[model samples]
Target chain A: MTYVTDVPEMAVAPAGGPPGHGAVPAADTPTQWAAAYFDGYSTVGLLAVVGVLFLTVAFVGGRLLRPVVPTPEKLLTYECGVDPVGEGWAHTQVRYYVYAFLYVIFAVDSIFLFPWATVFAEPGFGGTTLVEMFVFLGFLTVGLLYAWKKGVLEWT
Target chain B: MNDTLEVALRLLAVFVIFLVLPLVIGQTEHKVMAHMQGRLGPMYAGGFHGWAQLVADGVKFAQKEDVVPANADRRVFQLAPAVALLPYLLVLVAIPIGPDNAVGEAIDAGIFFVLAVMGVGVLGSLMAGWASANKFSLLGGLRTAAQLLAYELPMLLTAASVAMAAGTVSLPGMLDAFEWWWVPWQIVGGVVFFVAGLAELQRPPFDAPVADSEIIFGAYTEYTGLRFALFLLAEYAGIVVLSGLTAVLFLGGWHGPFADELGWLWTLLKTLALAFVVIWLRATYPRLREDQLQKLAWTVLIPLALAQIALTGVVKVAIS
Candidate 1:
């Protein structure tokens, strides 16, 4: 009984391949597809479990090892040795929100660009694919230029 | 039986990464930064070179008082450090440590998985900041979110360009693509990835989110004891993951001069080199103003990343 590596075999299996011809048996059922997908991530799942355990041990060990003597002054929020000021909640600047909005635009652009790149490298793609990508990029460039001109790009 | 073996091996690797690597890297960072500042760091801890300094620090952190602010949101505050550290571990699951020593079984979208998980760390910082009930913590958290959002674009774009060049988003596949003619063409994307990665990791020049002098350690301002140690662990873990990703994406993961049997060593060497650069940057540079960081990301790095994508497209077309 030879051991099987999971991912590469599953990835190379044609969608409708004949029974017993691939690592996965022929089953058009959604359960089979889901199982295959889950199998691919099994190692990751194991690692996640280990990771949680590692953190739990560290936190628990620290709790046991550490002293617990909390004074009221120690529990007060730190303010550069000054006495506690007003409420902890303060009005944050809107500039950070604006950066997030700008990030959203480019993030979508990147999402589109990744799939395009993967498709562009396919055997049949050529100069036409290249031109289409540039056109897509052209729209993004225009948006960026608009943002630039409006000084949204300015950190101030 | 094979599946169990594979799982056991991966668990050992994860243990090494989570438990051991951080201590070694943290020590190296202290010594390197100290040397840069013209001081001998940790010289007496392990007898000769203070190699046991990290061990001592760990024990000290373990023994310190765990404090929570009276007005703080207890649940979020308690959980933030774990949240921040968790993603770093998840990212490691997808990282190919060597040609043959990849911890987990390979996922086709390995690099994408890493980037997406890394993005989750900002939420941890945000939680820490907002739950701390400190104004400085809030500011730090918000700044962290903004900075991560700003830099993440260029980092993704640069990575996408590398993916396009290699024609594979899988970590091991990218390594296989580095046969001879690939390195020179990847130089631009590589540089962009490094610079944006620095911002993503919030290391020097780009560390405004945690500027100690400005915000008293930012989101970590109110954290004490073991929780603070966890945050520091998260940071060092972030550095290790980013450095490993850099080696995989640009410097060719596990591929170096000499024996193929020693591939993991090469990967370690490359990762340490990149991590040292990060520590060097922290030692040398002053923190950039928040606005300067934003401007650098949006105006400079983003455009350069876009241009790199265009250049990669043209070169790919021409060569094909």
Candidate 2:
């Protein structure tokens, strides 16, 4: 999957290891050309090879190691250690999840407002920044206050 | 050399990323979620704690039994899971993950556009449920639609406040200023947006569509093999996309403690940390009531989002 060497004349290094080229640096080196995990060839065309290397490594590693053992028991629907009885896919408490889901929707909206106000001092950007952020936060707040008064945030 | 070639090459790089990065992050999400819940997720997979879980999962899915219900609509059933997944995968194309101006904007309305398009994921879930030829699954899909439609509005509103404040929709430029992040004035708004994203991602406490206890895996009940894999991909991909958006819009995009050389790594680390939070929420919280979920969205989240927007406006007007 390492496409870098797969381009044209470039030879690819094996997965998890870089190309066969030594770790030699060019003349005007900036200290060192560090190879943290793996290093690839220095050719321009092989740059995207990192992606190929990445795919190959991930796929191979996953296939060779992850066990595929599935007994009749292992295939049962998760029952928290209870002996499996009916089909695992039976309908149960979806509405409860829906409630939590709705809450999550509202809660996520609240995470954005603070940072919007923090960047207000970039030269002539303060006033413009404030107006835009507020307009944005406006819709968010309305949604929240509505939910709150409606007693949605209150846990039973 | 030529613009088209460069762009094409870049797009190719992006395609490779579509494969490699998601595989890495998606597996990490599973590992993190597993650990947070006091379980070892992939401990036996790839020598080191199931590092190969996702890859194995992908392969297994590709080869495992591909079952479609005899009564199901084959074309739509197949397409639904893809629908759930494709938009999230496609949206990653325009995302500048490295922080700063490393990647220029492909579309000017980056935040707005992504937020709007992201909503399409619900449709896939909806279609999956409907096409499954199962009552439980269809209901589950509708639940997702209801949950999302309600929440997307506030999510947009919260993002709207930031886009409004930035004065431009270019995410990288907003981070280039790199002064104040979006976490302060609208802490409330940030919280809401994050919660909405959690719901959208179908994480715990809000995992209605696939609620095993209720709908027997709900909309995905009829799916097996590759289609189920696509749904899983969409789930993890959605998490990554939301994490990236959170980092960009609220946490200062690419602005880390060192916004110079380590900017790109810092942005990824931050987004990675946020993804951990999503996993954390799954570990810590219990599911809520259905009525409460909707009430929270329409009554609580939307109003708060609107108020934050209004207050932001008033404060700006007064100061200026």
Q: Which one is best on DockQ?
A: 1
Ten residues in a row with the worst lDDT in model 2 chain B? B100-109
Q: Across residues A1-156, which tens digit of lDDT does each residue of candidate 1 receive? A: 011235434533444444565355443456545445556577677778877887899889988888899898999889988888897888766755666787898798787666566668667897888898789778878888998898887644
* Candidate 2 stretches greater than 4 Å from native: A1-156, B318-320
> lDDT tens digits, residues B1-320, model 1?
88577678876876677677777789999899999899989899879799999888878888998999999999999999989998888888777766654645566677778888998977888999999989999888888888888889989998988888877777777776676456677777788889888887777878898999889899999998889988998889988988888888888878887627777888889899999998998888888998888888888888888888898888888877
The TM-score, computed over Cα atoms with residue i paired to residue i, of candidate 1 is 0.93
lDDT of 2 at A114: 37
Determine which window of 10 residues in candidate 1 chain B has minimal summed lDDT.
B98-107
For candidate 2, lDDT tens digit of each residue in B43-83? 77778877888778777876665565655677898778767
CA deviation > 4 Å runs, candidate 1: A1-34
The residue pairs found clashing in candidate 1 are none
Give per-model TM-scores: 0.93, 0.69
Chain B TM-score for the candidates in order: 0.96, 0.93
